[model samples]
Target: MADVNPFYLGAFAVYLLIVLGIGVWGYTKTSDVMDFWAFGQEMGPWLATWSFVANFVSAVSVIGFIGAVYGEGYTLMTHTIFGLMLGTSGLYFAVDRVRNLDLLTFPDIIASVTGYEVARPIAGAVLLGNGWLYLVMQLVGASLLVTAITGVPYEYMVWVIGIVFIVYTVLGGLVSVAWTDFLQGTVMVGAVLLALGYMIFDFGGFTAINQQFAALDSAYVHPTGEGAYTAIGIIATIVAFFGTIFTEQNNIVRIAATRDVRTAKLHLAASGVILSIFYSALVILGGATTVALTTSGLAVDNVDSAFPVLITDYVPTGVGIIIILAVMSAILSTTDTRLHSTGITTARDIYSYFRPDSSDDSQLRVSRIATIAFGITATAAAVNPPGTIIELYNFRAVLLTSAFLIPVYLGLYWAGLSARAILASIVTGATLGVGTEIAGGLFGVPSTFIGVGAATLVLIVGHFLLSDTEPKGGTMAGD
Candidate 1:
């Protein structure tokens, strides 16, 4: 049997206790269906800021992103960061607009924007689909962290983590998720900074690490010069980042939870700045890992294992546990929100579609049931496991961004986009995106680009093709 570190286990237990305490408190505070799902639109800017940033830093970022940079080098960050900033700034513009609409669900916003009743259900289906895959990815990430830190069997860990996630989400809804996110987001940032500090101090210093990287290869410093990832790949990363930030329903719910339009905009700006700094720091840390690995003549079979190896090998057991906790935080931070979002989507989108007159109490009841059901299904899938965390996330990114990115953006900005055109755009883009992804990298372009291109083509052609008959009512017209 592998030895267990008492400090690690103790720390993990304390973290779980705190999270559960927060969930129980939030449950007590939740008075209505709106309060449960949207925090009653009373969230302060700081909490909203933390939750917004937390929404983006999933296990994929902690495990997959760090490893990618360690293996590939600078090009990963060059466009990826730019895309994140672009998306955040775009969302900043959307904050007031979204708040003003005061919709119950994200799909309702689409229906409002397009003046089409049909747009709601389409958006709902897409969000729920994305939520399922995303939940599975987070489950995989949590299981990986547990197995690495506790020497637990991966299959057992998935069910264990899955049940915990379901319980918290079904108990407290978005209110609990937001407060817990605030706590975890702070921990995640602190732990990452600590990890970087440890690496730098252990490896002599920044100067020493930089010299080691230079000694190894100059391509490590050049943005587009190293590894298998091409400029095209970078472009796809940007699109994924931009699309996810702009269109993801989880984020929309976060924004809706804020006090007002002004608070929402402030939170978005702050979250963007925070996200940029933290992610940039991660890039540097990844590069530092590359230097450390090369200088020590140590290597791991999988790049995703690089950070874990660095933590367990070099850092003290106490600090290493904190780092492990941070990874667990990263996994839970996103997983709970995704689970909650799925419940909301199922309740408001699917159940409401069938029974439009269902009471709020009834909706809440269905949401809890759906949340538990989705969590269990994702847990079952996690036992089998499919691929690396990043790969799974990237797969969903294309599928999600293609289906909703263009439609949402166009619905928000373009008055001429008809209900028919928006619907057609989502259908065609999603179809092409999934088909091309399965077809595998035809024409040297990523599936994301092809899918987005297909959507954009239909939007433009269909708009001009059907301009005279398009709907006249829009957000701008009423305003």
Candidate 2:
């Protein structure tokens, strides 16, 4: 690792200070739980759009996916980018209905759609689990970057970054998160473009870069790389990513927070466009890193460290810091959103259900407490993450999509689903999702296909068998 640059440390400090300032400002704007949880449903298209983009494009995309591309070639990018764009387009179909529901949390949407009080807690649990794992992924990616750049111990950097975001989240909730996301989103775009341009120029041109990368190893430019990626894996990756967009609380909250359905739709469309360009650039940059490292006779022990190593040792210091800040931006932007959603899911979905008469003030207090608790827990987990960043992300996405995709989306438009069916779907999906994921996809079939498939089958079967005899949970709240 390069020596710690004082200039980089100074710039990082200033950035953290700016983030804290934004949190304080967001606190001033927040007057109640509504403001904290949903930005008071006052966000316009611009802020909502950027916030959506920032939250979706986390450390996983910028750091994890980039590393995957560096190691695995463009196959990973093809599946993930296609899945993401397809999922974003799917959001357009649900925006008007989802926004009009006026829900505060994903669990609330589930509860409202199912009319089963029990469904709220089950959905909340799934959400919290998903958020915690994803939060750890963000922290792991950020900690790696900061550690490589500043030579800070990874364990200590994990807590430091975790505590900073947790404090702001406990202070301002979504208000702080949205504004910071907008800023972070802009920085992320700039950083990616800068890195991409540098790579292009350094290697002569796009074609030359690919030619050089191919010279090192044909597999570096091969579609499947070293054959680690299979046809089944690619299909599963797409389905998992696509289904995740429907159930990801962070993304759903942004849509619900928008001023109107039109704004929400606009946010989704714009975010999708920006993310497409941003991710494509990252794919190019990943290939460039391969060529740069090989030509420079450098090697990284952990593939996940490829991006940080490239920026810190290969790129100019000024450009490197910008990309570093972009990594920080990606980390903080996603962490705060996950922390906020986890808190809200705890307070509004689970806590409030047990105490239905709890005042808004009471729920808000619990929300902050929950945020702090989860933040600490996630930070601890990040110190020794359970798996690679992308592996952890895939697990989170598969579980959430399996558990919530069928019940939430189908319940939105269909009215025949019973509480029993919804509950069965949640339980079955989560169980199989975890089991299949742990079993490494059950004979090359992705956990997503099995879990979501089983969930859908169970829901439909349960509905047909039980809906006629059992009482429906009543129509969705808005209906």
Candidate 3:
């Protein structure tokens, strides 16, 4: 902990107040379950685009993953390429179709396509699990930013951040989340761009960075640089992230919120371009951070401290506050979405499935309650975070993708997909995916690739081998 700048603290207080004000505004606009969950499907294309980009570049990307780029070297840039590819797929494949669907949540689509009553709850459970995991990771990163700037205890800051999120999200739901996301997204881009600009101006340019890295090792400059990542490793990383964009509940819900299919496409297209620039800047900033830290003779106890340490040591306090707010913006934007999505999964996907007779009004009430419950649980997990932010993010994304990836894509396009086949795929995929991840580097590929591969194989084999009935032609939207 260190002494805080009065101006920095005052600026952050104002930012939080503004965020709360937006939440209150959203509370006024939200009327029912549909409004609460999806903002009545009235989102503008640019708003949706910014929301998607903000969610995509969460606290993990702003802080922890940037640290990874610096510590791990240029080879890790493959993940950024994978993220860009994910955005492209969203534009061409996901946006048009998902927005047109009558379904409300990912589980609704799952059950509809598979024609299974059980699939809904299963999907809900996985959504809740992964959502909480991601929420916890963001909270950890947010608390780190808070502690660094305000000199607050990390444990205390975790609960404080959680409480503020719960208050706004519970009161306002998706409407609040979306509005806040738009503002946060704008701030996030500007903050990061400024940080990058400052780094280039203060530290030497790319040539100087390379010279600094040369003193360390030449591999830092190479694509397939020295580290744990290989060609297969890059593919595996790509596969995990690509699956996240397509199959994750939080992302899918954003697509469903778009005003129309055309708007969805436009939003996705715009998001892809924005993300490409954002991620490229992040990668370059990572390289610049390594150079800055080395030249300044700063001692980083943990690699995850790179971004925060760089700002504190090299940048002025006023500018540091803006950068920290940017980090907060990234964390809050993503965290609110996970919170809102978890509530929807619990109330709409799980509870409503079990109690089909429940009214939308009661469901809305339950959703608000669930939002608070999830916030508390995630805050507890953040108190003692298990890994670096990127590790948590990647593992949770892989877990959800393993369970849903094969079934979701195949269900969308392949008419013959069966409920039984989906069950087998999810179960088998989880087993192999977790097993591979547990087995570590000796397994030679990311757990996501292994798990997704297993799921796809089982699904295809079972569809051909097990079904004696004739081909059933139907789309996920219709089913």
The TM-score leader among the candidates is 2
> After aligning candidate 1 to the native by TM-score, how far in Å is the CA of 382 from where it should be?
1.8
- The order of the candidates by lDDT, greatest first, is 2, 1, 3
Give the whole-model CA lDDT for all candidates, comma-separated.
Answer: 0.81, 0.86, 0.80
Writing each residue's lDDT as its tens digit, candidate 3 over 127-203 gives: 88889999999999888877777777889989988998898999889999999999999999999998888777775
> In candidate 2, which residue ranges exceed 4 Å CA deviation?
473-479
So what's the TM-score on candidate 3? 0.94
> Residue 159 of model 2: what lDDT?
89
* Worst 10 contiguous positions by lDDT, candidate 1: 470-479
Provide the TM-score for each candidate, comma-separated. Answer: 0.94, 0.96, 0.94
In Å, residue 26's CA in model 3 sits off its true spot by: 0.9
Model 1: per-residue lDDT, tens digit, 1-479? 26666676677668778888888888888878898789998999999989877778987888778777776676667776677788888888777888888876778787776777667667888888789888888888777766666667889889988888788878888889999999899999888888888878888888787677767777867877565567787888789778878778888888788888889899988988898888877887888878777667778787777777766565689778878878878889899999999889888877877787899999999999999998999899888767777677778778878887887777788765676787788888888887787788668888999889999889878877776886566533221
Write down the worst ten-residue block by lDDT for model 3.
Answer: 470-479
Query: What would you estimate as the lDDT of candidate 2?
Result: 0.86
Residue 121, candidate 2: alpha-carbon lDDT:
82
Model 3 per-residue lDDT at 465: 72
- For 1-479, candidate 2 gives per-residue lDDT tens digits of 35888877777889999999999999999999999999999999999988988888888888898788777777777687788889999988888898898886787788777777777788889899999998899999989988888888889999889989999889899999999999999998898898799889988999999898787778877766768677877788888889888888887788878988889888888888898888888888888987887688777877789888887789999889888888888888998999999999999888987888899999999999999999999999999999989989889888988898887798888976766787899899999988999998787678999999999999999988888776565633322
Task: Return the TM-score for candidate 2, rounded to 2 decimals.
Answer: 0.96
Measured by C-alpha RMSD in angstroms, how accurate is candidate 1?
A: 2.7
